[model samples]
Target: MTNLQKAVILITGASGGFGQELTRQLLEAGSRLILTDINEAVLRQRVAAIQNEVKTGEVLACLASDLADVQGCETLYHQVKALDIPIDILINNAGVGLFGRMDEIPRQRWEYLMQVNLMTPMRLSALFVPDMIEHQKGHIVNISSLAGWCAIAGMAHYSASKFGLRGFSEGLFNEVKDYNVKVTAVYPFFSRTPILQSERFGTLAKTYQGLPEHMITDPADVMRATIQGIVKNQLHVFPDPTANRLHLLQRYFPQLVYWINNRMGRSMKHG
Candidate 1:
């Protein structure tokens, strides 16, 4: 794989756990990043830290915008064009999660998750694909999860969003492969991130109750795997060993996976 040195990359959710780590690695790898997140203050703080660390690699701009609204996505496109920064890699990493049974999660909350996790990526891809086409080179990386392939009780909505994202990423990959544009969808297992605190998964909640902090993978690992995938132009990336094993199990012994997941769910609930 050829090096994508100083590639202009746009990352959403720049203030969150994975986003922050990703920014750090991209800077270290000599990539010019345009960071954006809903939280303006955190975004500013992240950008400042990166600026202080690297005098040479570029930190293009940090803008604040909510990606749930389609109009906001349109505004983001306009803002990027106005800045005249060439976006060589687009990381659709902004997403939210809800941990509840299908009927337990509120309609608005479910919709919001869908908007952020599934819809926004497609909207941003649509906006950027033309430019990539014109330039005849680009890469799109969608951050998905292990939930996308396997079912987890109480996280129905969250799983649905990731499952949808996986499908979208796969379809987009095929569509753009002939255009000299590469697309990679990543699936990772549980990580020590703020998103875990944001969800209320009935079964997983119990398991997490007494879990050691070190048991979860670090956000930096996720960031590193994502970067490695983009650099290698891989189609599917499993960022963690556990996530990779689960994915493999799902591929060949789905019934066994179902049994194992169900047993785990029961154990968590009973614990």
Candidate 2:
């Protein structure tokens, strides 16, 4: 079991709903952390508010950076490196959401989403994995969505980004494990996070609210499961119950899943 007590960790997207919850839990678990987000003001405010509750775990720094560009990722890497901390855990938790017809979403908007959701994670992992390998003791956690496992309609671009993240995490896990490093890909379905408030493209785009209330999860629940998975050294973690059920259906009833997706896609065009 991986002990989080005093573990040096870095979390991207540390100001978002899921990231905030994860940050609090990690701090409570006695893990030292370096937090980063795209918004500097919000991140600093978040850190300031949490300082009173901090008991054992330390917040190393709240370095904010835009993770959409390769240069931004490299800059964040260099900033963290300058802090002189050997990060034990790197959580690629930052992501954006998009909802629209495959062709309706603007090219640049979807492209920006891809860079933030997929490219940033790939870049950050590449920057940090070498240090983890050298240490022979570390964990890299990718916060992928269930959409990555079971692709659906009205979210082709979002699904594609998540699919890429899941794929990268899968390969990276194997590549670094020989060095005694750990990697975990976390899949949570429809959590009640700011991503749910993500910008929509088409006027008739389906929203996460369309799903049944039971299908939406709390960010805290999802992040709690993610932390537990890390402690257990799990490779692939489905934090929500719905994620597992859907994964099984997708695996054992592939045609049925495809047909459902087709119907949904058809309805999006008509509805």
Candidate 3:
């Protein structure tokens, strides 16, 4: 079991609903936290709120840095390293979503989503994995999405980013398993997070409006499952029931999965 007590964990996008919930749960479990987000004020506010409640583990530092650029990723890494704290666990939770047709979505937005969702994790992992290897211990959690496994309309770029992340996480897991470093890829279905408030392009707003609200998972439940996965050293985590069932179905009935997604897309387009 991974002992979080006194373990230094760095969580990106700590101000978001899922990220904030994860921060609270991890702190309650006695993990030292170094939280980061693009919005410094909001990140620090969340940190203060958690400290006011749990008051157990240390909140090492709450630094805000944009992770959508390589320099930003490097800066965050160096900032943490300068503090002389060995990050025992790194949670790559920062991500953004752009909803629209593949052709209609601007290239700039697609690149931004890819940078934040895929490249940032890869960059951070590259920077920290060596240290974990030298110590022969550490954990990295990449917050991928259900879209990664199953392609869906109106989320082409977002799905691509997550799919890349899923592959990277799996490859990293194999590469580091022998060295005792664990890489967990979390595939959560839509959650009731601010990410749902993502910018909608083309006809995405109309499509999203037709989606069932009940389908969205709870951030708290997702965070609970994530912490459990981390402790158990799970390589692939399907936290939500919907995602788990879909993942199994995709494995057993690939054609059925494609048909369902195609049907959903048609319905959204017509509705």
The best candidate in terms of lDDT: 3
Q: What is the C-alpha lDDT of each candidate?
A: 0.85, 0.87, 0.90
Count of residue pairs whose backbone atoms collide, per candidate: 0, 0, 0
lDDT per residue (tens digit) for residues 1-271 in model 3:
7888899999999999988998899888889999999999988887888789887888889898999999999999999999998999999999998888888888998999999999999999999999999999999999999999998888889999999999999999999999999999999998999888788887665656645667678999998998899999998999989899999989999999999898877766665
C-alpha RMSD in Å of predicted model 3 compared with the true structure: 1.5
Sort by TM-score, top down from the best: 3, 1, 2
Q: Cα deviation of 250 in candidate 1 (Å)? A: 0.3
Candidate 3, residue 158: lDDT? 93
Query: Which structure among the candidates has the greatest TM-score?
Result: 3
Expressed as tens digits, the lDDT of each residue in 1-271 for candidate 1 is: 5255788999999888898888888888888888999988889987788678866668888888889989989989988898997789999999887776787667888899999999999999999999998898899989999889997777788898899989999999999989999999999888888887776644355444422445479889877987888889998999989889999999999998999887766654654
CA error at residue 95 for candidate 2, angstroms: 0.2
TM-score for model 3? 0.96
TM-score winner between 2 and 3, please give it: 3
Residue-wise C-alpha lDDT for candidate 2, range 1-271, written one tens digit per residue? 8889999989999999988988899999999999999888999898777777766688899998999998999999999999998999999999999887778889999999999999999999999999988888888999998899777766889999999999999999889989988999998988888887677767546432355456589898889998999999999999989887777778899888788777655654554
Q: What order do you get sorting by lDDT, best first? A: 3, 2, 1
